[model samples]
Target: MSDTLSPKAAKLHNRTLITTYLYEHKEATKQVLERELGISLPTITQNLRNLEAEHIIELGELQDSTGGRKAQSYRFAAKHRVAIGVALRSNSVCLCAVDLYGDTVQERTHAMSYTNTPMYYQRVGTLINEFAATVAKGGSTVLGVAFSVQGIVSADGTSITFGTLMHNTGLTLETISQSVHYPCIMIHDSDASAMAELWFDPTIRDAVCVYLERRPGGAVIVNGKLYQGPNQCNGAIEHMVLVPNGRQCYCGQRGCMDTYCSLETLPEEGESVPGFFSVLEQGEPHHRERMHTWMEFIAQTIVNARSVIAGDVVIGGEAAQYLDDSDIAALKSRVQQLTPFSTDTFSLHKSRCADTNSIVGAALRYIEAYVDSICTDAE
Candidate 1:
């Protein structure tokens, strides 16, 4: 077959290219776009006009010229449409509004607890709608809402296939989407966190993301994509057994990694992870010992995971933010001692979106969908 671009395909390709460049660079002039994209000046102007008419792009102040008339600048209207992401936890909910560029525009937390009853679902729907209403007041379109649940999500993102922690197993997407006046979907919290990492750093071809939250969970990225297993539980690393007949995990598993490496593992009876870290930083002997054990367990888990999947390990979630440089060095040393090969073969990375990975990732689901729809449109 001949390698040629049809007129329609070329138009679509140019539009996508121009829009993507503006989105990435924030702003550009018609001449700059023409020069950078290698498109004809008229074609660049036409695409810019179309984008501006659609409210996807807007005009910016003219740039100063060296020896000619000032050139008009165009900018991508990143916040023209926003996506909402909700993270449902056992005791509270986190709501975030993200723009097309995956930047969080607004975020809030609610003290509501999770209950599988219809009333609870209705309340969640109401909260989402109310939040959207506030966001819409800024004259921005609300594209959709995505829920990040700490459970196994169905392949179609329509139901919670496994949610023992929140007792929300079998919950359907419609239960909450019904009250909200926009597109919606369900997503696994770990999966969403992994997506956020991929969005933040597209270079991650293959890696393991371990979320050291109160209840540890993880996701796997294979070949630059999420590897959902047959049961869509490919990255349920928390359930991996670390010891036989040891401490019980919340999932009722004995000696699971969650019981040893989770943030919950470091805290005292009423101390939070932050409090535990605070004392640990102060050189308290008890906290120091607990953190040492925690790092050892985490190192072992990373080594075990690498034995099956070879890639960088990204440590994320609420607890990961507390990990300082010294902590990373200690963990790296521990991991090096466990592996036969050199530690230089693999690497450990701290999550850039430590606190908001799941929330941002959840919202990015719809933002990406919108961009895909635009880029894939043939007409």
Candidate 2:
């Protein structure tokens, strides 16, 4: 829950907290920071001073006081530090560089099969490093790396235990990080994507996110925190057998959401989801129906999730490229037809639209861990 170090970590912890909030609100006075951070005046002043000295944060114009003296406000220097996040699925890898506020600064991706092989990791490492080199070229300093993969990630961001959807190659975090060749870390694909929503999304203070990429996996966010259970695979929902009596999933289950909803369910050679949609666009009613079934399955899953950790469902993946207004509406309609409610609260999200999400999420998580390490030492 906290970062490492004694006084330095305490200072970085406070800076991370203050800067995190400021990244959202844009600006806040010391009094507002005190109320939100719940720290003493000296601690606030001290940390803010340290952050300013480090060029990680900046002070803006003062806010008018209510019948009192004006107070100076603080804001995160979004450009001062840079972070990288990478989302690696079974078929492809996406790497991005993001700013302090989760803004994509630079990004690129490489195409590869998710199956575990030395070549795949080598390719992934090359892509990430290539993007980092791009970041350096753009004159932005790189801070750290975050890796989001499809499997069970350790809480410490050190290793992956179960990767049902990845190359099935059984890769070790140590090996991958060594290949990564920077200050690197790892996270579950869902949790890392959810971190994208957490540090940057303003409306989602509380919600549940079910992210589906070409690879089937997801993470849940409760009270603005990713709920990672022991072994760090709490929300890896693709393994959950929804039908228990249907199609065989890669995870050895019948009729799971992943089997029905993923592109893998649709066999093709060297095809993108956009190409699949293009087929539908060319009037392939069968593919169209496949999409409809996919959305319906997603809806039913959300409706079922309501009994547990329900709030709002977000659909995001490489498949999101073809999610037109009509597709989204149809998905909503299907959910409406199946669920108790008339209106659909589940939202569709797209990360491929943002070039820097992976790097950004990685950077943010790294910074968060850096701060979390500091606080626990004191406790």
Each prediction's whole-model lDDT (CA): 0.86, 0.68
Q: Which numbered prediction scores highest in TM-score against the true structure?
A: 1
Off by over 4 Å in 2: 1-53, 57-76, 89-93, 111-134, 137-139, 167-170, 179-181, 266-272, 282-284, 340-359, 368-379
Clashes of 1: 0
Which tens-of-lDDT digit does each residue in 206-240 have in candidate 2?
45566656666677777767777776766666766
**What is the Å distance of residue 316 in model 2 from its true position?**
1.1
Query: For model 1, what is the alpha-carbon lDDT of residue 192?
Result: 92
Top model by lDDT, which number? 1
Query: Candidate 2, which ten residues in sequence have the lowest lDDT sum?
Result: 350-359
lDDT for predicted candidate 1 compared with the true structure: 0.86
